[model samples]
Target: MSLLFENAIGDFELSTATLYSPTNGDLEATRDEPVPIDGIVEYASYHDRLDHPEKDDWIAVPLHESDSAALTGEYIAFTDHALHGEIFVYDDGDDYESIDRDAFVESTLAERVRFWHSDYAPDDPPSYFDSPIAEREPPRRPLSGDDAASFFDELESFVRAEMDAQRDANGEKAAGSTPEALREQGFGAIPSLSSLGQPEDGTYRFRIDDDGDDRAQDRHRYVQREFGIFEGNEVQLFPPNAERAPDAFPIAATVGSIEGRTVRLAVDWHAIEDRSTVGGYLRQKRRGYAVTLLLNSVPYDRELEAIARVRERDDHRALLTGETAVTFGDTAGVKSSQQDVELNQEQELAVSCALLADHLFCIHGPPGTGKTRTLVEVVRRSVQAGDDVLVCADSNQAVDNLVAGSSTAATADERSLHAYAQHGADEFVLRRVNAGNSSNDVVGERYATCDGRADVVAATNSSAATLDREFDVLVLDEATQATCTASCIPLARANKVVLAGDHKQLPPFSATEDPPESAAGMSLFEHLYADGGVYEGVGVQLRTQYRMHRDIAWFSNRRFYDRALRQGRDVASLADRPALVGYDVGGSEETIDHSKRNDAEARLVAHVVDELRTEAGLEAAEIGVITPYTAQVDAVRTKLTAQLERGREVTVDTIDSFQGSEKVAIVISLVRSNADGEVGFLDRPLDGPRRLNVAMTRAERFCALIGDWYTLRDSRGGAGDGTDLYDDLHSFLESTGRLRRVEPEFIPIPE
Candidate 1:
């Protein structure tokens, strides 16, 4: 016997068969069948099994809880007839509880029971059943163009109506007032006049009375009359005073009858505070003594239009340069005393400025070579030439320095670099000049109305690239750090481009990589070499370390330069430089051991803090801790603050946050490799070359690195291994004279 089942949700059907064994109980199984069901009417036959051996067996049928309840007390019984099959029906038994009526009706069997039986007639034809559900379509969105246009049009109409109503309410009839009538009423110039008509030479005459009649008439009246030129028509006299009239006073005057043959007329004029004026008037008609009212109006629309155009152009230029236009007075309050220290690259700065003045040049200097100071001098010279200068740097600190210095040197009204480079500043047109904000064709139009037309524009390299017009001089700080792609735009836009940064520090992150042929490989100059070509361009090498002590500088230079010379690199030789000195650390490698206690890291941090606080007399804000790993940062932070009293404020930032930042003193904690030989630096992967490079370079004025110098030496295999990480760092120190081990100045903490 076969059975049918259906899934209500997806509406799929399953057919099954029952098998009987004389020894075992009845077994239920699935069968592939062409069965005639009640819901699906057709004459069909059932197959006992499929051809596959696995499918030829009967399996037990499992039912859900609700379906099992519906099957209680049901029995399968075979009929005597061949065409008829066994049937099962729900029945209450003594041992079995009655199948739950509610549960059975809500079960899947209750829905399947309706399809169990069908009238099996030989002439029956097949019929189909269709689902009641229907498909749906997605909703539509409204059009933006129509809505936007409608909004703006409505706004314009509303503004125009409001302005017209305001004018009318103020008694300003622009097109229909007379100047002669206004003056005849003894007013100097009617405050509501639109326009004043020129009066005829002798058509009107008047006599002024300083003391006519304060009570009966009014103060300062005028007497009107008709003269020989009167071709009489209706005339209206103002002030309406018959007592003030003279004998034989007529309605009009002739051309020669008036003194100097001139008549003064007044009209309705409106004076808007700090904005504009409007008025109306009355004048004599060409043919008669009678005067006709004439009106003249002055609207501020033209002036407002000019102002808007100027503002738009200024905004466009500001966006293009990443520099906002500002007025000099806005930054006058900033003090110059804040920047009192002289830069170490003073001579190099002068040379750079001279080069920028002479030609399009690049001032390639490494970190601490004072590129920022050099660019400032370049800006100063450009300002001296009466050229508008644009100064751009990669960070806000760089911009601040440029603005602070330039504003201090410039006059109150002179256009400073800040005014042209800061956002929202008055002259920030270059900052606004972007393709999205303005049309490319009209990009430079704003510069036409600049009060100091030859102003300087300063911004970062990214900002400079967006400018459409060429500047008098384009100075790029940290030029070596910029990729070739970033450099191309500014180089193309400037009349003179100055690339300032050191290639030795770090090349652009995006430059293509191809190993140089050899140490003696052809340089950029040699590759492009030709007879009488520009191959001998001068390169300036700065050989000074003003920030470090002479001994520290000497040790660092010895280690860094010797390796470069050994590698056959074109590094500068500083062996004979007298300013260099050697640091004697008592030859003790024992003090370099990793701290044992959790408090050891804290003590080390506290030591550095105490040194900065006592010896350098630095403020907390001027000090920063830069570590190679986040764990080490956490360790050092905990240690530094553990011993401090409550309510003390100190901040610790990661190397990522410290980038493009400067501090008076920086303490570097080099997190040691863990037991598994893992170390991280600057959030970069714990690789050899990168770790060594990053761990050595994050200092502005002072650095105190806490790491195992012994591990560094052991890793290098006696300092001669060419591939060793420490060897690389040692070589850099010798060449640059910027890093060296020394007896750090220690300050004891209070007990």
Candidate 2:
């Protein structure tokens, strides 16, 4: 949430109706999936054009229709430029008649886009069956490669013309040279790098997206796989040596062009018949290459049998044996925090579980429970005992947070006494720090080398996956937020694992399915926590929370945590804090808006923020507005930022944003207000408690909850079909006199 307001969406862009999207792909496909675009914009104006950005230039396709009709507009002359990536326009419809089919087949440029349709689906494949792409169909005819060569030529012309218009950019800054001479010079300077691998039977492609030549490859073969180095715009030919790579560069032809860091080029089959060209940068592409190998190279046969026996509790004989916790050395237990602070009972127990060499440990860290602190100490102690440690978290912030702690742990005390070994050949190069004083530098580009190597190798879960070295311990903080598969990535390199998270806060974040049925949605922490009391010693609960006041936490602790959590002693003065209160607001619910935002509720949240500041004597720093929905969060943020007075630093965010931090007063705006007791996604019977638990427990002096009590109290599914944990919370709050009904603030109509 902080990232949204501070770095991403501005106040106006946060309006419920504003659209958003991403336009980039991940460098490594196997390690990180490409980010998907979202919420379509209504139109692309001339200002959106890369070459001709004037209002009169781009011809609009249609107000509501698709871009396929762009050529029918008055600007048919500009269609050629758009076809070859030379200029941008309002729509991206292509001209299928312009492509040549035989040229495409000659290049083995087969495509699946036009070849198949969704005509093959199952009637019932059973509840557990989950296919990656859902369904498959027989092959169909693909597009042509004939038009692709012409498109690149047109693209070259577009690039030269745009350079002339933006005189200050590219080679245009000079006034001496004619546009023709500058274009020639610009085209000549396109950068090129050498290729790698001792010239095996490796094949590359000349893929121009939307061009008929863009083809799909057979994924079943490893050598035939395409890494897609440069935006996939590649070209190639066939020869006698195509059957196997030659020992030297065969007599070949190559074409190259450059625009900034990307060197756009095409090489013939002759060039790839040898590797005397690009080797260094090609080797750096090892990130995703290794991930693919690791995933496919699993010892399936042995691991499957071992897993079955272990699961049935019959024989624990053989799995991938090596660095089990029992074989790994034990810790001498020399650990300390940033300031050498003493650990509370809860922190002590959490750290003790990790040092005891348990195969698995579940550390329940509720809001402000110092979960990261305990995990840091565990890693430091284990490393001091002469064992390599890999600390991982699901998000980048959490990963950097742990590294910052370890950086402090290493520099603040006698951590320098131990000798450290860099994990692999490269020093954390998968999205790494450029240069800085410490590990925090690893984030956001400013970073330094490991001049001062910390005791542990820390990174986001997948980022550290390239390291195949065995480690003594792997601590996963905030484990419940990651899917079971994501959390297990560290287990592949560790003997023992520790899961530190509270499933009662937020489960795995899946944008697709609800209550994720796939293995990716099942969280490891959730599984171990709910697997019965057999996990007594392996699970340690951190009950003392420093975030909420005693009175503020009374209801949530008793109702959510089974009364196990306590307020820290240092904050004992706040024990007499006003009890957690709920204002029903008789908040009327609309018939569940599909847009997932409520402007009226957003204004009400701003109204609550104003009332608290003026009536309750609280500063903006003490107030926070929280919602469960992203759209609602955006809506409320827009209201507060645009309407609130200066110096009002009130933050508006979601549960994930406030997970590790807290404010004096937290106001929750339950966006769902349906009168039918349909609480939308937030009211899911199983996930309801996690959302409510984190929301209600983030307050220190005051907890203000504004929602439709009638609807939220139902504890049922979206359609009121099933019951859940919220039912019990509603009963407890009503019985204890903590619940009350109120009205939404009255806003006057404009004259």
Candidate 3:
């Protein structure tokens, strides 16, 4: 006699058997005949791990849960011959067929009752199961051929536009036009170079010389700063007199070392062998020969290569389509915890969904939500399961946050991410791969330089592409701020991808206007959840926030999140603290030189900072002053520094620089209070006003907004001018008694 069990989920095959016994964890099964009625089934001794068994002819059996539970111990006693019939089993609101009762009774009487399970969970049963695989929507189509080319072209064009904008902002142009054009101008036209030292091995050395031109010096500094050539970056080297021949064009070389004004270039042997290339440039002209460094083309070429080869790779296809060969169920034992405090329900669900994802998963994290905490838990569990994981983000600061954990710990005794990571560091290797000089004392002191094999590696998205090995999973934090093509370089190296970001906060930015017909200008994180995208209605959203007070969170919660955001357990409300305080400075906005600044607003902010310091006893380090423009940042920082007591340092920066940061008390300076009601980039169309959302969510206890109410509310910046957001804030603050006009000396919280 043989028993046959049918699975409710159709996609996966029965790979392992599980039996719950009080003494031993493994299942003990002895079968005379194998069955393959519907799905692949296997039965073997608990001690002997067996592969799929051969198909056999077996009669169906019916069994009840109560009857199965009653029979305990090693085996159950049953009659050899009984009535044959199928059992209709309802498992968690789903219906499926079970083995014949007579076959099961005889089989169980001879052998123990067998339970199907996954190989990943041999000790524990699955705590939760996702929706049936058959019910899920088909994976989205992957971009290929002409569509792929067009998408990459638009993405590259957007990058170029941003580069050009930066150059224009700094009042500097590119080095030269093209190879042919540079050759037309004499080799002397290029920047002069001198030999650094004697050649060693395959490395060619040169020193960048000051040609007595200020513009040339500025351009060199720009290249070094923008391209990060001193931080071991690679750039294309074009000798001034390099032959115009096809093979003698610019050659790729690594920035081996940079000291003072000298640089060492590690050129390939092939390029060094050719007399017309780098070797000849270094050997023939030891001094006075000009060389041009092509800094812009490196990223463009790398992105194009990733796009060109993505479709040919299976993992890349999976990343694009959200389909994978393997699937997972939530591990029941994995609990979400930050040291001692357990995670909220929404955060726990996000952790489960991230693990259960087959190919791609998107975690929609609103501001102040415990998305990072949730993601770190997922990383710990993934490493425990012996999967090599890669964590990446658009910025080095975001990556450092993931590695070192939160600086603003919610609880006083809460342990940091480094502590959590160090707990399991002995079990597996953890490495921090940074491309920039960003380092906090927390992460920098401990993991400043970790080499060799690593079970988990944290890096920026740009640096992840340079890794030699692939990862089992890639966790991309702050994914919404990176372009699709920028994400593809790391996306190509992993089989599964998890994206965690807030789409409502900010999308990928382009200095130039987006192409009229290209969706590639948007971030992949937003694209996946938009309208008919693959993970559309399927991604998990963390609804609870632990950082902001309820009053401070109310505007963004209602405006952007549709009131889905709520305060955590101990979060303060209006009754507990002055959460949302507004000061209508009615300041006159003016553009000094070329940058925008408001003198009245700056003075008002300085007064507020002074009051907070004298009355509330809040130090400058505890408070943050944020603005929208660089000139305004300088203005606020200057005024606050001069007005405040000596040795008081207040953190002041633009909105973009403070994306992944928070503070105890925060103030914002809206510098566009002009008569024309021109808000500049504050109210851009299509992209929405995400900068305001980011700015408002940074405060934990108290938040203050100082702006010209008339200019903001009566903006004439066409459709979607974002005036409605300011209107909403005004109404909310007025109704809640949080709005106040700026006085000579004002207090954040009225006594």
Candidates 2 and 3 compared by lDDT, better number? 3
Which candidate order results from sorting by TM-score in descending order? 3, 2, 1
RMSD of 3: 11.1
TM-score (all chains, Cα) for each model? 0.37, 0.52, 0.68
Error of 1 at 593 (Å): 27
Number of colliding residue pairs in model 1: 80
* Better candidate by TM-score, 1 or 3: 3
TM-score of 2: 0.52
- Model 3 lDDT per residue over 1-751, tens place: 0111112222122343222222231112334553222221222211111222331222112221322312221221111233533321212223322334334323432232333222111132222223322113344544555654465466666666655664343222224354234434431123455665457766777766665555654554443652234434444566545554336445556667665456677764564446554455455545654433434345555665666566668656554555532233323112222222487877766666676554667888998888888887777777775578898888888888887655432221122346455433354567777534566655555554555677788877777767889888889999888777778777877777889898777676655544212455567786665544545534778888889877788788988898988777566532334877887777677676467898778888877777667777777788888888888888877777666784148888888787888988888988877667777777664443788899999988778898877677664554333477787777777788877877533533221
Angstrom error at residue 371, model 2: 1.7
Mind giving the per-residue lDDT tens digits that candidate 2 earns over 1-751?
0111111111112112211111133111222321111101111111133123333433221110111111111221123244453221322244212212222222211111111112212343323332211222111211124432232233233333332333223222222333234334432121122232232234322222121222332223211222222222222211223234334322223224322222233334444533543332233322111100001112122223323333333111111111111111122332322222577876875675466432566788877677777776676567655666777787766666655433432342222111122322222221222212133532333222344544466656655565646667778887888765456466656767778887777777653435554333557666444333112334668888876667667767877788887767645322333446666655444333343665666776787677677777778988888888777776777788778773237877887677655777888887666656766667565576667778887777777777666666664444653235555666766787877665455632110
Q: Is 1 or 3 the stronger prediction by lDDT?
A: 3
Give the CA lDDT, 0 to 100, for residue 681 in model 2: 65
RMSD list, candidates in order: 34.4, 32.0, 11.1
Candidate 3 residue 736 Cα shift, in angstroms, is: 2.8
